[model samples]
Target: MRADARENYEHLLAAAHEAIAEHGAEASLRDIARRAGVGLGTLYRHFPTREALLEVLLRTRLDQLTQNAGELETGSPPGAALVSWFLQAVAFVRTYNGVVALMAAAIEDPESALHASCETVRSAGTRLLVRAQAEGTARADIDGTDLFALIGALGWVGDQPTFSPRAGRLADLVLGAILTPGEG
Candidate 1:
């Protein structure tokens, strides 16, 4: 991508995250474009559909989270890494809100960008979860499937207009409890 195009793409990601965090599922693409300092045409050029844009924006956060595995491998304790990843997941759930419903449907149906992103999560997230479990920190019984289910279930909590402020603390409490004591 050209410099300007790259900037636009980054802006779109930032705008989408902010808008979704503040406005939930009701966030508008037009407003996202305006916040990005880009025209709707440019957002269209980068992401042709609102769904596509939301998918990318959500995946962008997930991708960052996926990278945490690498960073965690550097020296972070297994428990800390697991907690960090879960915290990031909660923030991601907050930003995307109810968007995972679309992703869940897409990944189950057939070939789609959603499936591609799911594969990404499976590969990296599995590794991270395994690492935590190896240390007996994460619950041995809960696998990637369970984690995904939990994240999806919790996304709705973050989507609620009244639930926003309490989400971070609630996520911490919920995820901490899910982890096997030390894992949290």
Candidate 2:
């Protein structure tokens, strides 16, 4: 990309991040372009679709989360690692308002722009869950898909005005149900 175009891309991403943080996944694309001081055409040239833009915005963080899972798997006990990774995943899902629904859908749709990154994150979480189950520290009935759904559910709870305050407690309760007694 040319220097000027790259600059515009960066600005658009920054603006989109702010907009999504404020107005959620449904934030207006036109408003994002206006905030970036770019034309709508420019924004489209850079990101052809809303999901495309969101995929770019979230890909780096998703990669980091996947890496964190690997590190936790090696550095901590299976149960502890799964617990820590689960908390982090929930936090990531709540980063941009109203993103939980997008992520849940993306995980199921292979054609979605966010699918690859979401899959990578899910696979990482699966490894952690499997390790914990192997150690008899997590429930055998639940699998990676269940873990992903739990993260989405917790994130959705965090997004609610009435339930946001209780998100931490809710997360603990959910995790308690997933982890075996006397485990993490």
Candidate 3:
């Protein structure tokens, strides 16, 4: 991609994240284009549909969180790393209200792009879980995928602004539940 095109795409992703975070998924693409200081045609050239744009926006954010697991593997204790990453997942769900609905909708097709995204989260969480177990700080009965599925279910709790106050506490609650007997 040309420099200007790359800049436009990044701007669009930022605008999309901001708009969706503030206005939910119902925010208009035209408005997002305006906020990004780009033309509608440019936005559409990068993303053919609203859902496709949102998928890219969210995938980008989730990918960052998943990648962070690798960075957190050092300095932070294994248990702390797992709990922190899990909490970040909660924030992602809360920051995008209908994200759970989107995720659920994609599960019907196992080979879909969303399925791969879900697996990325699961794999990242698995790294933490494996480390925690190795350190005797996480339960051996559960793996990363199970923890991720649980987080996906928890996304419903993040579906509205009214529930935002409980977000961190709820994250801690679930993380507590998943930890080894003596860990939390």
By lDDT, the best candidate is 2
Write the number of the candidate with greater lDDT, choosing between 2 and 3: 2
lDDT of 1: 0.74
* Candidate 2 accuracy as TM-score: 0.96
**Candidate 1 Cα errors over 4 Å, as ranges:** 1-14, 34-42
The worst-scoring run of ten residues by lDDT in candidate 2 lies at 90-99
| Candidate 2 wrong stretches, greater than 4 Å | none
> Model 3: per-residue lDDT, tens digit, 124-164?
88988899989988888997768877787678777756876
Clash-forming residue pairs, model 1 = none
Residue pairs clashing, model 3: none
Summarize candidate 1's per-residue lDDT along 1-184 as a digit string, tens digits: 8998898899988998889877765588899999999899998999888768766766766687778767885668877876777666656765656676766676576556667776676566667778888988887888877777676666767777687677777787778766786555
Q: Per-prediction TM-score, please?
A: 0.77, 0.96, 0.82
lDDT score, residue 133, model 1?
86
| Model 3 alpha-carbon miss at residue 85, Å | 1.5
RMSD of 3: 2.5
lDDT of 2 by residue, 1-184 (tens): 9999999999999999999988899999999999999999999999999999999999988999999999999999999999999999988888888889999899889999999999999999999999999999999999999999999999999889999999999999999999999876
Backbone collision tally, model 2: 0
Write down the RMSD of all candidates, one decimal each.
3.0, 1.0, 2.5
Q: Which one is best on TM-score?
A: 2
